[model samples]
Target: MAGLPVALAAAGALAYGTAFGLFGEDARTTAGAAAPAWAEEAADGFASVDALGQKGTYGGRGGPVVTVRTLADLEKYATAPGPHVIVVAGAIPVNPVGKEIKVASDKTIIGSGTSGHIVGGGFFLGPGVHNVIIRNLTIRDTYQGVWNDKDHDFDAVQMDGAHHVWIDHNDLRHMADGLIDSRKDTSYVTVSWNRLGNNNKTFGIGWTENTTADLTIHHNWFRETEQRNPSTDNAAHAHLYNNYLQDDPGTAVTSAYGNYARGRTAMVLENSYFQGLTNPVIKDATASLVQRGNVFSGTRGRNESGGTGFDPRRFYPYTLDAAADVPAIVTAGAGPRSALGTPRAAATRTLTVAKDGSGQFTSVQKAVDAVPAGNSSRVVIQVKPGTYREAVKVPSNKPHVTLQGMGASRKDTVLVEGRASGTPRPDGSGTYGTGGSATLAVEADDFQARNLTVANDFDEARNQHLTGHQAVALRTAADRVLLDALIISGDQDTLLLDTAAKDRPGRVRLTNSYVIGNVDFVFGRATAVIDRSVLTLKKRWDGTSAGYVTAPSTPAGRKGFLITRSTVNGDVTAGSFFLGRPWHAGGDATLDPQTTVRDSVLSAAVRPAPWTDMGGFSWKDDRFAEYRNTGPGAGPAGADRPHLTDAQAADQEIADWLGDWTPAAG
Candidate 1:
């Protein structure tokens, strides 16, 4: 209980023994009939809390039990009247004619064991369908569908205008669109203890112009899903608690009204765990949220609300979970699988790359190209001790990839390339842009690099006569990316976080890393956090009197960059380096750049009057601030540097910056 809120801690302890205390007193119901042994266990596991679908009431209460083994058999019983219990056994493959299976009212579909599977089709709950229970099965390889012409809508389970539905303990993945979706007046739904992965869109709640969705999403494991871990549009009331989200590209919970009539969306998010995600909660100007006891570690994103405000207690009367206990609790019991079981061996495929003929591959690019297209599981590429000269790219289709280097230090295994903004392509096209000039470019989600050095060896003195001197060492456009114990070195524009064309902005986390450059080396528009790292500014080669450190082009209403508990050291002359400047792309007046540097040491290499102008844009007009910084280069009072007050610092915490997602590192 390290960071637990006192009120939530007391409540969790009080509800430890009583079964009905967990769900609140309003959810009690009478036991109607005797249930099967397996069904009883499922009820006991989920009934700790009481809600609309508690005690399996959504399923058949008094009807006879019907066991199903084939797709045709299941389809035959789906339309039967009266409360019925339908148990599924063995594999059921759906037809390929774009047919959807429709379910009726008062039905229960339970898988007999772990061997139950539903392939190539999905379940639909719409119109008069009500009181349904689906549990203990695997739904995979559903037809890929489209939504709004641009968004993916492939779904393993879709509910529309339904009530009292409970979907629990199922593994869903590999769909063309979303894994689960509930929209258009769907109410009283509980989704728990399920595993969702390997899909573009994971979950979606509230669609079109309707705003009457009452949902509870708890104890679910979302792994490696790209976006919309449920995009909530004008949802009336949504309670998301105690869920585990890992390696998500976009926002974990999106509450916004895009191109729709403005309405209110009230949300309560508590005791959730986020690891390697971009933003946990992104709300529009019309949305309202109340967050409490949430832990975010090693995550980056904005959690603050930009719209209205409301008290969450008015919507529901429930006990909160302690934030400090969320990681252990979620890790132990969140997914359909239990963490208490025996540890399994690593399932990821490992390949070795050596410059000599000792390994399977000689070049790093060749190893990256060898990855199977649209692979689901993680593939680890281990590079032996050698310097490889190449430009590597991990495409968007190839996700869940890791690049590990066998080196004592980051300097031991290196990837070197030379390409600046002025460098032209082999064809007679324009030169490589700032992003295209990176030595190592990553476009896939869930990408990780450990113990490596990526360098752009552009000759600054020789390229002084060139038009654009920006040479990037790393350009990452994907979300949920991590860089650990790495060295990024170049002269200008060394590291670039490019999300300019993405639907949602990407996020990055850098821990124990070193970045060296002279002008705008660490820059971009993505939401990034640098912890226990170093930013060094080298001397300028053009014989200029001063240089700039950062040039952020952050969009309005978004967090751009944060450097906490780090050190800024440089080899330049005293008072020669400015902290940062602003970049206005296409002279967009709506863009507002933001950056913060707190609790760090600034060397004398930093100028006293930091933050200069760039592209005819004044740095003072942007959002830049410093807090609790000390050293020789700390700018004086009344300088251009704005100081953050204690109250403002409290509001600008890293936890609030990340919302419900807790980062792994501070």
Candidate 2:
């Protein structure tokens, strides 16, 4: 434990050493109690186990039981002798001295509760290791071994040349490399009920020449994870079903073929839900993939590759879950904590806020500050129908918070602030960035707000003297956020779906909402979906030409903005407002922005040439496409407006975009 943090090191020496006995009876006796409810359900729902594939009991059955409370104890039990049911208790933070903590054959290491945590270090199931189960643990901040070094790649859970593994009910985040990776002949693995987020490479199944990997990943929630949401490479047979993927900046499931030896990577992705994703499925010409019963709402790019003619059932024996039922099922059961377990009474802890002191607090910020730190459960802060001029923020640690407005109409309840990008700090420091210049800013995950108005009442003409006049009404850097029936109003940069960074993109789902702005009003790098929403363009007070509706700064190879099944109408003059213009941040030539408007109604305010060049970048070089658009703006004659063909349009459905995330009616 050389790299152990002082806090973890202070937890003292290892407890419960080598007193445990071997075999099923001894293990059961040592375990003391039965498995948790989640564990039982995981076992019953494991696809590999239910399919009757592979070797002996996959999770510490017929083995010895040992409880570990420290990093040293975990290391001892994980590597000592054979077949162990290692119960890890308390927060075990590991700053590993070696490559990683290694796990031997036939082992089940489960956390006692949500308390079990592995920080800075990770577990490695290396060559010849088989029949393992790693469950109910929170693995975070994994060691960043060597940068861009494949051999020394650090992952929270790495299965190499291993088989018969079940990784379930675990929460993994902020890992350096892959969160969960399986490669080199690994077979018969099921990854379920895990919540993976804020990772660069989320999941990787097969490697260059490892063709024998068979992975089943289902009912897991992947939030704001980047590339390799299980990138099946070179002969990997992966079945991805009933998973909830939200705001993935990169492709969720990519069937990649190696250059040296291109094997048939067969992936059956069905009944999955995708929201605010760049590309749901990336099938190369050499790969074999099939997608069915998936739902997509505000997603960009084509869902499937042009390649076809591969049947998934021919390779694996498994029953397909209905895609229509997947959203409800996965949302209810996926992740470490069951969504169903979220008490209805949690909403009862409502803190009411009103401008006239008719509620518990006078302002929204007061109610938010009163919330207990590390609040695990959902807490609703109700705002009565009144305009409160304040800047509000929901910090990162205060998750599962909802800001509800008790307003009959969205315009009735308003949270208004007047901070532009050039607005200096109260302490007389430099101005806030575009992300910081928001009336309402949310950084917490699982945040929700409905039936309210977040308005940046900064007058664009008054702020014309400032250089960066971008004022955002709402800025969200959160995951799994839902904004419904809301009105976000501003001038430039009205609604900023801002993220912490380019690598860590935010996720927000907007439905039946109204966004009104001028120049690049709705912009950011976040993967945002605007479904059945209204995007309106307002005329500048100074009679300046109504600027671009969007100036998306989405990272290269990522989805920026999607307005689907919605309406874009405004009071602007005809041929004045272009749909969007690409914003090249820091003169990055590689930044290719993506924006799509399909199956929507556009007014005459939208120019015939809807996309234009901005910041020395051509909109034509970016990904801006429309399909089946019906309005005066819809045309086949415009050179700037790119239209999708019938075949391409067939792949651009909302069902294909959202995967299986069917948002409830607003």
Candidate 3:
């Protein structure tokens, strides 16, 4: 909640006085015009609550929004660090067929329109992984040609010891195991608006004996699915509402039971319709179950109810549609919709770059070259996964240009160049110098790059004889720029945050990303906020342990670099790195540079005296400070080290650094 999400969330929290009102329209989970209405919506029901040391279900809400087509890309983003809104846009036939992709935390794997499909594979959420949303996709065909296959434990979506997840609007069927398996005491989950069919084990609630799982399942159509229409076992509170369960005649599959509560589970089933199903509702002797306003037609067997179950309204407010309108409503809106996850304007404003020549252009620069010089609208350059061995530059005139990597992980796509400050130009125009050594130079306003790795591999060890070693991975020379979910790696001066001199304005937001370097990696004069990202302190190429994370050269009172809710760690020598130092930039004493690292975790690699003097400019005179920093490297404030007061730190918030410019997903 560092950047635009905080403001968007407040506006969304009043939609309908219920859970629908909890999120704003701008708190979008999808991108493009083809995005479904619900795909843009946030989590509902139990998954929307903040409990069990986890935030509410905001799948990649504050991170980048990307579209994935291949299994490798899906797994990469699913397992990558930080939050990502992954839109599956094509039929990705699993390579190994039944392999279950282990998904990490803070992710949204959604389908693009009706075309997105996960064939013969599924997703798995392991222990401690939270804040996930899987919606509007077709996950099926892992049947192994066996109706009761016990060999393969394949499931469309499975979670073990995971919490705060929402599985909605999916069509899951024909899997080797349960389509949706919430096992090992997974808590705070909501299963809604999905269509589960053609499976033996449709859904299973528990594998653990502890009654700690909390769930809310609603607005789903369970058709021709056998048992465990989500059999709740050892669950603390299970609320099922407005669901349609039916088994018509001549169907190959038959319903065993609609909803079963067992092993000390407490369930409250309400406003559900069941047709031609046997044992629609059942409760074990050790479980507590209550059924209210349920419709069971042409169904025989145990329709039992007993003790009072836990109240769901005590958790989160929800409004349920009438039971009679469930089949009609779910029948039309259960699976993927037409508008969800599809490209609204793919024919325009998008350029494709691939090394394999599958895209419109073989090189990224060729695609950038295609844009008109004075282009005003935002144009996205979708670069496929490959090592682009070239430098890229976005001129200042080409504003609102986004270089997006078509990979699940940032490491999958690389824009690399081995250029250093001393690298000679082919035209014999002398050395490239510090400003020209950048691999990816963004000199345009409203520039953005995501799911990409921009690196300057200058080979310092092999090129030690070279005069200058300043290699910059990324450099921004414009304003309103966003580098989300990216990895910029180098040794010295890795990321230069700059402006068009002192008179011009520039602001960069680097969120949920990694900036790896040794000395002055994040040096610049621009007003930048590195929020919720990692600053990896790698050893210099010369094997030197000493380094500086930042070197800011801000003007008198304007904000410089503000690092918040980030981590500073690496496999470097302890007490060898300083947090930052003021940079007078050519010994200009008029510059009152400032850098503040607050609410972050610093490793022992950081020196106790984090701020040090440089070029006869004492850091004490500048604004090199830290506030409420933790970890082994953090130290007390002293004459050499500066710390911001609570009052002063409040003014340095991310909102303070970025005023009305809310950078969001394209």
The C-alpha lDDT values of all candidates are 0.68, 0.69, 0.82
Model 1: per-residue Cα lDDT over 318-415, one tens digit each: 55567666656655554332111111223689888999869889998899999998987678889988888888988988876778878766666888
TM-score, cand. 2 vs. native = 0.50
Instruction: Tell me the lDDT of model 3 at 215.
Output: 95
* Off by more than 4 A, model 1: 1-346, 500-503, 542-545, 636-639, 659-666
Whichever of 1 and 3 has more TM-score, that candidate is 3
The better candidate by TM-score, 2 or 3, is 3
Residue 569 shift from truth in candidate 3, angstroms:
1.2
Provide backbone clash counts, one per model. Answer: 14, 11, 9
Which consecutive 10 residues in model 3 have the weakest lDDT in total? Answer: 15-24
TM-scores vs. true structure, each candidate: 0.50, 0.50, 0.52
Candidate with better lDDT, 2 vs 3: 3
Residue 79 lDDT, candidate 2, scale 0-100: 87
Q: Which ranges of candidate 2 are over 4 A from the true structure?
A: 1-348, 637-639, 650-666
